[model samples]
Target chain A: MIELQNVAMSYGGGDLFSEISLKLAPGSFHFLTGPSGAGKTTLLKLCYAELMPSAGHVSFMGRDVRTMGRDDIAALRGRIGVVHQDCQFLDHLSVAENVALPLTVARRPLDARELMELLGWVGLKAQADALPPQLSGGERQRAALARAVIMSPDVLLADEPTGNLDWDMSLRLLTLLVELNRMGKTVLIATHDLNLIRAAKQQVSARVLRIANRRLQLAGADL
Target chain B: MRAVLALIRADGRGVDRVVPPTGHTAWLTVLSAAAMAFLAVFALALALATGRLADRWSDALARSATIRISAPVDQMPTQTRAVLEVLATTPGIADYRALDEDEMRALLDPWFGPDLPVETLPLPQLIALTETAEGVDGEGLRLRLAAEAPGAVLDDHTRWRRPLVSAAERLRFLGLISLVLIGGATAGMITLAAQAALAANGQVIRVLRLVGARDSYIARAFVRRFTLRGLSGAALGTVLGMIAVALLPEADAAGGFLTGLGFEGAGWLWPMMIPPMAAAVAFAATRAAALRMLRGIR
Candidate 1:
């Protein structure tokens, strides 16, 4: 679980936003919605310990993230997969290699059959050998999602994962996230698409947090 | 990102793999190391040879003093006998010898040729003297000879011999310094090469980091690649260099000229160390360069 208590992040004091408080309880699902440069990615980065809170404390897995050693942070990050909106990948690697990277970095032996099954879930088995550069935006998004969940992580954080995908592709990715939540993994997604959030509500009971007035608030029943 | 995961999970405890994948070839590094190592062999040989030359020059010149009695041609034998008698009673003289007819002729063979009749020529009588640990004062011996045998002149061979030994020693030192410079240059080049390779693989590094790969693991991939290249290349250079040295014509005893260029006896083992030393240099240089490059990103 990730907890941010009285957290304030800023660029030159009043440039963007600051003074936020939130807690991502275990096994819960939430969506973070904000306008461009509203600190959505910055918040996600803070949760993952990639960025410090600037002021106030951010705790990951019960340890203050700022005090954690680099190696400790890396180990903690291994258990929580992240999907970037850009679908970052080593283009020289095949789709399968890219998807299996988390397990690889963790140095865990991978079962090829299980990996193939996961690839099948995302409908990317046929493109397993294809490089990231050759994949379409939809395929890339799905591939990115598959990569994020490959670790069977206790928590998942995706920053606009479906930003580049079409509506159908977006739904496909959303369905995957819902399935993961049903399997009991906490998921926090940062996205600005209200329709996607409205659609997600129909599939799973999830909370939504919005960044406004330099603080986070529950955007209940707000499209 | 997936690659980082795979790397981390491939080995338990998140240990960074120091060895690169087999297909990550580095022929250029191997070639460079080999070429440099080969050149080092010659430089090493030069150092050793000059070292030996210095020792020989010192030993051959040490403790040797010559007595030249320039009496009238007819009185030369008498003056030589008198000088030898006086040298026998001298306190500091450890050993003394009067050269035989053939021995004296042989000494002048280089200048006078084989057929010169040494017993017939009225050359001044030469007496060889070796002094004790505390060498005899040449001037004191000269004054004694001047009083008893006024025509006797002592040549200690000090002036030319000291300069010769010093020059040889300086040459040996120069060779050693060249080897050090060569090693330094090799390390410098490999560092630059590693930096270039890392820069070229920036995207790869970014992807690996995204997948949770630690900085050490990413740097390992590069360090291992360059280390192997440097080792192999240096080996080739060393072997080829030794062969080239071996092919050189054997040294002749023609007074420290062309023949002084190659290794002598057990000195051959010196050049063999060049490859491993080169590899060590490459290892250190690449490791340093990779770590610096990694930290720059952080």
Candidate 2:
């Protein structure tokens, strides 16, 4: 679980967001909606300890982010998975290798059959040997998703994971995320896609939080 | 010691496979190490040779002096006898012998040629003196000789020997300083190469960190690669240097100092240490660069 109390982030004397408090409990699903440059990605970065808040405290699993050392932060990252909007893969590696990178870095043994099954589930079994640059946009997104969930982390944070995909690919990726949430993994997705949020609400009880006027408000029954 | 063991243990762990292969920095590190190691071998050889030369000259000249009697042709015999009697009475004089005509001819043969007219040239009479462990006091011996044989001059070879010994010692010190400078240059070049590699692989580092890789783990990848490269390159350079030194013309009667600039006896084992030393330098340089670069990332 991640908790942020009265957190604020600024850049070069310009405030992006201020006085925000949010808590992500276990096995809960949430969608964050905001306009472009509304500090959505920045908030996700704060949650993963990639950036320290300018003024307040952010804690992961009951420990303050500022109090943890570099090694401790790395260990905490193992329990959380993140999917960036760009699907940042090492372009030289094959799709399957990129997907198994989390386990590789952790020094955990990888079962070839299990990796193959995971790739097949993401419909990337045929392109396992292909590099990231050779894959299509949708394929890259699915590959990033597979990589994110490979370690079976307790919490998943994604930033516009389906931004480049078509409707079918988006729904497919959403279903995979929904399946992961159903398996008791907490998921928080940042996006501005109203239709995707509407579609997600039909399958699960997802709370919507929108950023407007430099404040995070629980979205009413508008959507 | 632990660092060395870690390097060996992490050899085939596939830790280095995370970072993409770099082109220019790889060649740069290897070539710089090889070049510096080659120079270091020569420096090591020079230091050892100078040390040995200094010791040999010091030992040969320390306990010996020469007495030259320059006088009238007829009085030469009397002056030589007087110098001999004086040396025999000196307490620290172990032995003294008046050099005959043939022995004096041999001494001057290299400079004056073989068939010089030694009897007609009115050359000075020479006497060789060897001292005991507690050598003669030169001032006391000189005063005694001047009183007894005014033509006899005592030359303890101090003026000639001191400068030669000092020059040799200074040369040895210069060689050692050269070795130190070469080591420092090697470390600097490897650090630059490592920084370049880290800069070029920023994206790879970010991805690795995003997936929970510690800075130590990331640093190990670069350290192992650079260390192995340095070891291999230095080993090649050392072997080539040894071969080059061995192929030089051997020391002869004509080739005095230049030909004698090489390893002798157990000295050959010294250059074998260069490869390991280069590896250690590369390991330290690359590890420092990697850790500093990582700190700025997240």
Candidate 3:
């Protein structure tokens, strides 16, 4: 579980967000909604220790991010899968290889059967040999999802997971996140897409946190 | 050591997937390594050859002295006998013999023609003294020679020979310095290439880091790649250098000093170390560069 209390982030001469407190409990699903340039990505980066809170404390599993060493951060990252908005993949590597990258980075043995099964779960088994550029946007997102879950991470933090997907593809991706949560993995997704959030709520109950005016607030019954 | 072992062994499990190969940087590393190793070969050869030359000069000049007794033809025989008697009592003198007229002409044959009229020329009588390992005191021998044979001058070859020995020693020093500089340049070039590769593959590195890859894991990929390139290129360069050296006219007593500027006998084994050394330099350079770049990111 990741916790941030009274956290604030800033860049250059302006504050991105301030005095934010949030707790991502075990197996809890949350949707982080914010308009463009509202520090959703910055908040997610703080969860993974990619960016430190300028003020207050951000802790992962009861340890402060400020005190964690580089190696410790990497080890912590292995337990938390992050799906970027862009679905960054090594462009030169095949889709299958990219999905199996976490296992490679963690220096674990690659079971080809398990990798194929994971790819099959993401519906990308057929495009396993294709490069990232060769895959459709939906396929790339799925591949990124497959890569994120390859390690069976305890927590999954995704930024704009359905940003470029069609309605059906977004639903399918939401179903994957729902499936992961059902399998005891905590999930937090950052996006401005209210429809995707509404779609996800029916499958799995998710609290929505909205970032506005440099603060995070639980949304009212406006939905 | 354990960490190094881990880094090396991790490659076997295929960590290379993270940072995809950049062709231009790979070629740059190999080419720089080869060029550096080639220059290193020449530097090493120069050092070894000059070392041998210095040794030859030192050993040949250290124990010997020449006695020149110049006198009128009537007094030449008596002066030569007096110089010989004085040399016989010299403590470090192993052997002494007056050069015959024909021997002196042979020494002068390079300057004057071989058919020069040696008997009619008023050349001085030259006595060659081979000294013991302990070596004669030139000062003591010179004083004795002056008393016994006034026309005799003792030449220990130190005046002219000192400069030759110093030149050889300086050349050897310079060659070694050149070798060090070449190695340093190779490391610099490899570091730049590694940095460029890391920069070009920034997204790849970012993805890898996001997936929980440690710095060492990322660096090992580049280190193994650059190290292999360096080794292969340096191996080729070393072989080429050896061939070039081998083809140089073989040094012999007749071929003189110019021919001696290469490896002789067991000395050929020295150049074989260059490839491995270049590989080590590449490994260190790339690892440092990769680690530095990784630290800068995230």
Candidate 4:
């Protein structure tokens, strides 16, 4: 679980957000909706300890992010999976290799059958040997999702995971995320897609939080 | 010691495959290490050769003196006898002998042609003297020679030997300094190459970090690759350097200094250490660069 109390972030004398308090409990699903420049990605970065708040404290599993060493942060990251908007993959590596990178970095043995099964579940079994540059947008997103869950992290943070996919692909990726949450993994997604939110709300109870006017406000009976 | 073992064992967990392959920096590291190692071999050879030359000059000239008797042709025999008597009475004089006509001819054979008439030309009579472990007092010997043989002069070879030995020692020092500079330059070049590789692979680093890779895991990949490259390149350079030194013309009496510039006896084993040394330098330089670069990210 991640907790931020009275947090504020700034860049070069310009304020991105201020006095924000949020808590992500265990096995809860949440959606963060904001405009393009409303600091949605910045908040996600803070949750993952990629960036520190200019003021106030952010803690992950009871440990303050500001006091953690580089190694400690790395260890914490292993317990939290993040899927970036760009689907950041090593362009030279094959799809299967990219999907299994989390396990590789953790120095764990890679079971070929499990990896193949995971790839088949993501509909990338045929393209396992293909490089990232050769994959379509939907394929890259699904590969990123598969990579994020390969470690079975307790929390998952995704940033615009379906920004480049079509309706069916977005719904498919959303179903995978929903399935992961149903398996007791906490998920927080940052997006501006209302239709996707409506579609997601039909299947699960997801609390919607929107960032407006440099403040985070819970929506009141709104889409 | 642990760092060395880590470098050797490496992360057999396929950690090195995370970073994409870089072409330019690989070639740069290998070629720089090879070139520096080649120069280091020659510097090593020069240092050893100069050391030997210094020792040889010091040992050969320290315990010997020469008496040159320049007198009128008629007084030569009397002066030679007087000098011999004085040397026989000296406490530190181990042995003394006046050179014969054939020995004198052999001494001057290199400067003058073999056909020169040595017995007829009124050259000075030369007497070679060997001293005991405690050498003779030059001033006392000169005073005695002047009283008994006025034309006799004692030369203990100090003036000639000191300058030659000093010059050889200085040359040896310079050779050692050259080796140090070469190693420093090699480290600088390898550091630059490692930094460039790290900079070019920023995306690889970011992706690895996001997936929970520690700094040590990331650094090991680069360190192993660069260290191996340095080892292979230096090995090639050292072998080629040894071959080039062995193929030089053999040292001969006519070719005095330059011909003797090479390893001798057990000295051949010295150049074999260059490859491993280069590998160590590469390992240190690349590890430092990788860690420093990783600190700046995230």
RMSD of each: 4.8, 1.5, 1.7, 1.6
lDDT for each residue of candidate 2 in B1-298, tens digit (9 for 90 to 100): 4685569566545677778998988987888888898899999999999999899889889999999999998898899999999998999989899998899889889999999878778888889999999989999999999999999999999999999999999999999999999889999999999999999999999999988889988988888888888888898889888988888778774568978889999999999999989998899999999999999977
Candidate 2 lDDT over A1-223, as tens digits, reads: 9999999999999889988899999999999999999999999999999999998899998899999988888888889999999999999889999999999888899999999999998999999999999999999999998899899899999999889989899999999899999999999999999889999999888999988887788988976
Q: Give lDDT: candidate 3, residue A192.
A: 91
Model 3, residue A104: C-alpha shift (Å):
1.0
Residue A190's lDDT in candidate 4: 96
List the global CA lDDT of all models: 0.81, 0.91, 0.89, 0.91
Docking class of 2: medium
Question: lDDT tens digits, residues A93-127, model 4?
Answer: 89999999999988888999999999988899999
Candidate 4 ranges beyond 4 A from true positions:
B1-6, B9-13
Best-to-worst ranking by DockQ: 3, 4, 2, 1
What is candidate 3's lDDT per residue for B20-128, written digit by digit as tens?
A: 7787988877777888888888899999999999999999988787989889999999999999888878798898899998899899999998999999989999999
Chain A of candidate 1 scores what in TM-score? 0.97
lDDT at A78, model 1: 80
In order, what fnat does every candidate score? Answer: 0.37, 0.65, 0.80, 0.76
What are the chain A TM-scores of the candidates, in order?
0.97, 0.98, 0.98, 0.98
DockQ of model 3, rounded to 2 decimals: 0.84
Count steric clashes of candidate 1: 34
With candidate 3 superimposed using the best TM-score fit, by how many Å does residue B101's alpha carbon deviate from the native? Answer: 1.5
Candidate number that wins on TM-score, 1 or 3 = 3
**Could you give the interface RMSD of each candidate, to one decimal?**
3.8, 0.8, 0.9, 0.8
